[model samples]
Target: MKLLTNRTRKMDVILIIVGAFIMAVGINLVYEPMDLVTGGFSGLAIIIKYFTKGFIHGGIPIWVSNILLNVPLFLAAFLLKGKKFVGKTLFATAVLSVALYIVPSFDIVYHDLLLASVFGGVIGGIGLGMVFITMASTGGTDMLGMIIHEFIPHYTIAQVIFVIDGAIVLLGAATFGLNKALYSVIAVYITAKVMDGMLEGLKFAKLTYIISDQYEEIAKEIMDKLDRGATGLHATGMYSNDEKKMIFCVVSKKEIIELKNIVGGIDPKAFIIVSDVREVLGEGFIEYKQ
Candidate 1:
């Protein structure tokens, strides 16, 4: 038990270091350079930076604003998730925020808005994805999303984040005018797409339910040729009122095409329904068996 606990702690520490590094790249490279405010506390900070630039007499910098905003979110995470998660998340957020401040002090490499926006969204999205992949997150509205999701399991984390960030964008639009705010929207969209691409992959997976007389052939082909697994269930067709065999399996985007080919070859009229699965858990997915 002690050994397992220690291993978990080690993994958490590694996650913190790697997550922090990736977040820094996103903030310094994409978000900051492009001045894109997606949403959340970070979005608020970006808005504050734009209007308040040089307005303060030795007041807190934009980076500090971001750190300060995260403080409450960190506390929320501690209360919501646990002390261990809060500690690691706080360390990572602080490191990334500090790194963002330091990295820019050296120089401004690109002044072109287009270049800055493109690079910033891409790099930042990758960093955000890396942090999320480690069973942890950068504390902010994301923590709030976790809290809300705990109570409302049906409420999506991504949608929760989108709403929070979208609110910030509205506020930014009000303060900064329509043009800059619109650009921020573009950056945010790009950031989201890039993040999803990195987290889920270029070719995402879909959950497919195949109902046909050729279950045995399809199952065998998937197991042997595709090197995948499938679950079979006994079902009765509503229209025909006849007993049917349903095969359920998850496959990547490319595999879906192959699966269609296999099914077509086996049974020209197989009832196949495909649905998008946002995240998958268990062996061959995100988590492995104990």
Candidate 2:
């Protein structure tokens, strides 16, 4: 058991390293060439790179700026989140910093700003998502987000991150032109969405609630045909004072049509409500693991 746990930890470390490297490559190759500012320390580093273009040869290297900017943020994380959180975060940050220095900046000369923004966001988002899955971050705005969340518990980490990134992008507009800043916003949006998809798992499912006269038949068919379990709850119709059974079931996105067909065949006027389920864990779904 101990060996297995150690193996899992090792795997997580490897994943974080790979993810951080990908993120660094995206920044150096795509964001740098296009002069696009994203969010977090990376975006700030770009902004710094632009303002101080003639400071030392071709401005201060992004890796240096990234490390300098992250120092205070890392300290904040250690104070607010604890050593355990900071340990992995620091490792990921170091990986990203080294990668930004070592990775060669590719010259991707292109006229389409939209394409650059999209590719940059996608590549960076995937890297960020992988790092996040291991419960670690590439530091920068991630750490700041955690600190902000500590003080403001009501706000989600993503919301706080957006606010921080948005402010940085605005600063970017001052230096990198308003048009590029606008495109940068698109990059940020795509990055956020992709990261969300990765963190939540792409295998999205649907949670359905059905209220109908033939509830038992529909439930039985769903169980027998779809091989899914349904739970029944007694419901009262306020308008007619009619007692009814509310059938609740979760089905894969692809199975939505089939489930709808079964319900319609049983009762054409069945009241059905379907909503997206991001992640589900149970006997038939993902195992609930600590």
Q: Which ten residues in a row have the lowest lDDT in candidate 2?
A: 104-113
State in Å the error of residue 100, model 1.
1.4
| TM of each candidate vs. truth | 0.71, 0.82
Candidate that scores best on TM-score: 2
- Residue 133 of candidate 1: its Cα lDDT? 58
Give the residue spans of candidate 1 off by over 4 A. 1-19, 29-37, 46-59, 105-119, 151-153, 196-204, 208-218, 230-246, 257-275, 288-290
Give candidate 1's whole-model lDDT. 0.70
lDDT of predicted model 2: 0.86
| Model 2 spans with C-alpha error above 4 angstroms | 1-11, 50-55, 109-111, 200-204, 212-214, 224-227, 236-242, 261-271, 278-281, 285-289
lDDT of each: 0.70, 0.86
Query: Candidate 1: deviation at residue 23, Å?
Result: 3.8
